[model samples]
Target: MAPGPAPGPPGHAAPDLATLTGVRSGKRSYYRAYVRSDERMQRAVRAMDSISRALVRTVEGPRGLLEEVARAAAAHLDASWTILALSDGHLRGARPRFLAVGPDGVVTDDDAGLAPLVRRELGAIRAGHATRSDDDGPWVRVPMTLEGRQIGSLVGLHGLDAAPEPGDLSVLRILANQAAVSLHTSEQYQAGVALHRRAQRLYDEATAQARDLEQRTQELRQAEQRLVLAHQRELIDTERHRIARELHDSVTQYVLSAGMAVEVARGEAEELGADGTTILERLGTAKQLSQDAVEQLRRAIYALHQSHRDTVSTLPELLHEVAEHHRPQLQVQVRVEGDVVPLTTDADHEIARAVGEALFNVATHARATRAVVRLRYRADELLAAVADDGHGDPVELSRLLRLERGRSADGRHRGLANIETRIVDLGGGIVFRRARLGGVRVEMRIPLPLTPTDRPGVISGLVGTPGDDRDDRSGDDTQEDPWPR
Candidate 1:
């Protein structure tokens, strides 16, 4: 255009100051673009490195991790201040804790009023809504999500020349992801520790309860043992006293009677002067009394060893012993009918005791010359009766039996109540009636089980003839119900 430039090479331009200057200026612009791109990549790498390091340090504590996240976000985003708020309300005491960081250090902001705003943003992000716009605003809200669950928010306040660029938002999003993972991991670890502590406390309480129960069980065992030992000692004492009373009442009385009979025989021999026949008769009588005493002694010794003996006592033998025991006091006779059944030791003893008591009462109160004991064995039961031939007041005897609480005038009524109790306990019933012999008759009937049971139970009502016109009293009057006192 200006007289044309010098001829240039084919398809090439001529050298000129303006062209050289333009080429140099293009190279400068390209170099400047490359340098700026390299600087941005380096800054992004450093920011990622910082985020990685901050996430690694999140294991220290929940508060420490929050503070680290806040600091890293503030520095990376070039913000005046950054806050990490737990929008899920995972904090203890249900109080919101906002961790804020600035360029200088950690700072406290009175953002209690902003809690509602932060929650709204977090809800919107969790619900998959578009992010809130804050292009020209001083506050930027970004959700911190993990596994697609929004845990909290990262709110930053800053004064920049322009709105946040895409690169800034990218870095902030990467940091938010890391922070969500770190915070979630830290919260999980804390929850695991709390659960473990609670389980340990419950285990300790159960162990303590087990120990106390074991101690109480041992104490109960010891107490039961002591009670058993005490019961055994009491039983031994009772058996000893019973043996003493039996010996005093039976053998001792027989020996005394024999001594008196010997003295009488000696006096009769003295009265028969030169009469050897009468003397021999008196000596024979003394010999018979001595023999009776010896027989009683033998019976007493047998009773003392009754526990170790296996011999079963028959009903006839029991009645014979009762008759023999009271032979000296009255003309006691025993009559047996039917087959004699074998009885238990307790039954035999109680039966014999009742017979002895009835005979003794006849001798002491009836003033009868003859007393008879009749025993009969039936298919399912046994019956025994003691009768005397004398006139005795049945009404007075019934009154005495009813008023047993009063002491007897002569102790003659002793053991009458015991006889009643023993026969009742053996599933037997006793009745007082007027005998055909014109005296009192005491009759008893006891039941036997089909299978031979050891335990004895009471059968209601007495089964026998009424004693006298005055002896007709109800069964209730004999057992639990008392006659009008």
Candidate 2:
């Protein structure tokens, strides 16, 4: 037998029959030991699995994660009841502070339905009196520590025959510490969410306040513009009243006295017979001219006395009024050809006065029977024209304007010069031509989108430029008669 069992393999020797028979008889004992060892290893693995599962429950919040931890400890030790509680003044933000799991796997955050032993362990852990590990009694206590400081305890009451081994205690400690860290993380997450909500609310309130402030600023600007316009109108009205008083009290009286002297002279010339024939005719003409001058002065006084506040506020309405004033003396038609453009109050007033002046020339000097006042609004400019059917010559008028501008500031022969000045001050030029209605046409071209520089107060340095006033008429009818009489 020794030779048969020898040298079974390299570096090995086979056992004898007696040794093999002894092993066969004690097979049951070895099998039982092996089975016990397998069960212990499986229990350790399950405990590790539970700890891993509990650690990842941080997203579930502190209360939920703590409950899972208590359940995991109970399952690991096969405990009749388990308690997990934070020590007093530790992890104060960790809600519910205490968590318990019964034998039936029911988890409760309150202590009302807990057994006496479970309640007592929870009270001790919360009171900060349960610090030491107890592995000798039926109740096992393990401290949940982080960085060498104990935050809480995990206590379990088991009905098992043996106390937990060193390996089992290690698994329990890991689960407890992991639970505490996960709870702290959950508390931090909640704090961040609350802060974000407060920031959003404050941003919304700030945006609303900014919008309200912008609206109030716009309203104030509009009110200021209205006040400025009212002030300008008041000044204009006051000046008009003063000029009317002067014309009525001074100029009208002088013209009337001159007319009376002319009448007396005409009566004395009639008594000189044939020698006084030419003198009588000349005196009669002078008397008639004086009467006309007095009549014109009276009309000016009446117009200046009328308050602009009682009249319409728009340019078209004012133009119509001007046409009405001349309708008695001549056939005048006002025609608007395009969408009316709104201009500043002063600009509109100046434009209307220029148009009125042209019409007055047509009525008094041009000896026109009919006239057309046209206002054409173009994309880039405005065309205001007064065309008349009369014996007026545009060439003579242009020459007169050049002559008048060259002379010193004299009140005489200022009608045409005044018209040129008004249009030029508004960034415009004047043109005179033969009208389709058989006489003169006075046309003004004003650029659109007028700026502050084009207003009345801002004068153009090239105002009296010879190129601004041009005669477009082909054949010149140079009549000796005074222009703009």
Candidate 3:
């Protein structure tokens, strides 16, 4: 290759008026060839400038530098094809791809077709700021040098008809060198963008997985809860059967035996007189005791029955309704006060039902003419109290605490033991004393769990806020532990 004008076949002068296929004659043909050659040079120069601009643009955006530069150059240079390949690696356009123009107007920039030696030479040429070539002169790789460093190479074909000029190749080299620098910057940016996209996709996937996992965990918890409830019901059913058997074996037999003895004494009364009468009286007492036993057994069975709707039980409504239900004969007044804010995540339906049971006990056993059923909700505690307008007898209260059997002053049955046991299980306390109305008052207080807040929110009662205690019972409030059960 030489640095000079390209040569063509000599032109022949002919008659000015001569005519031929799409031409006047010899002189016109020569003029056409000269114009074509000049156009080729102009196109090559424009292509080089386009390559420079394209490289710069690729660095600024997502477009691959090599692809943009090579494709543009091929079009501008009026070549049939163009390709850009990386000097550093294979067919990667994002990595300093170099352009090559063939004499036949065909370009092969595919990294796959490029020879390994050529690729190595391009890399060296870019790094060392020098050009290298193979043994044959047909292929010449012009190094694209910038700031004393060869970023890559530009190769052009040489044939017998066209001997590559040094000046033209140099021009190509300068443009290629500019493209190489721009491509290097663009490649770095491209790699960074790829990394960022990968990270964002991972983050999104992780977030979706977390939500799915949480949903699965909740489903598992629900399934476990159902299993526990079913098991509990089975146990209750077994207990009921056992209790029914006990009642038949003990209380029923005793009542039947006592009746037989009374009948026998009546039959012998005429002969045995006073002794027979005494036997009959003793049998009567025994029968009465047997009947009382039957009643107690029934109550026990009622307590043992398992509820399927346990989860849906609303303690306050149940309590208030019980008080009102029994208000007619007992002259009991049902008063519901305070707040019991329901929590969505709370699974303590048993606790609420237990509270309801306690209220039921008050109406049944307290033997009061008037009763005040209070359900108070403070920030820190939930309290319920059933006070009665009955006699001031602390003896019944003591018996309830001891869970011992003692006849009620009114000669009615008492349910104090069950009530006390339920309240104890609620982590609460109870106080039994004379009310301001001059009658026995049974007040029970249970602490509400603290809601999530910066300060110990809602210390007590409905008036409880961050630092308020409007419902803390004064002087007569007693605290009871719920774990004894």
TM-score of each: 0.42, 0.61, 0.46
For model 3, residues 252-272, the per-residue Cα lDDT tens digits are 677667666755665666467
RMSD of 3: 14.9
Where is model 2 more than 4 Å wrong at Cα? 1-41, 47-67, 85-99, 108-127, 131-138, 146-148, 252-413, 432-485
Looking at model 1, residue 109 earns an lDDT score of: 39
lDDT comparison, 2 vs 3, better candidate:
2
Cα-based RMSD of the predictions, in order?
Answer: 20.4, 10.0, 14.9
- Per-residue lDDT of 39-58 in model 1, one digit per residue for the tens? 55665677677666655663
Per-model lDDT: 0.62, 0.75, 0.52
Q: Which rank order by TM-score, best down to worst?
A: 2, 3, 1
Model 3 is weakest, by summed lDDT over 10 consecutive residues, at 456-465
**Count of clashing residue pairs in every prediction:** 3, 0, 15
The number of the candidate with the highest TM-score is: 2
Candidate 1, position 289, lDDT: 55
Q: What TM-score should be assigned to candidate 3?
A: 0.46
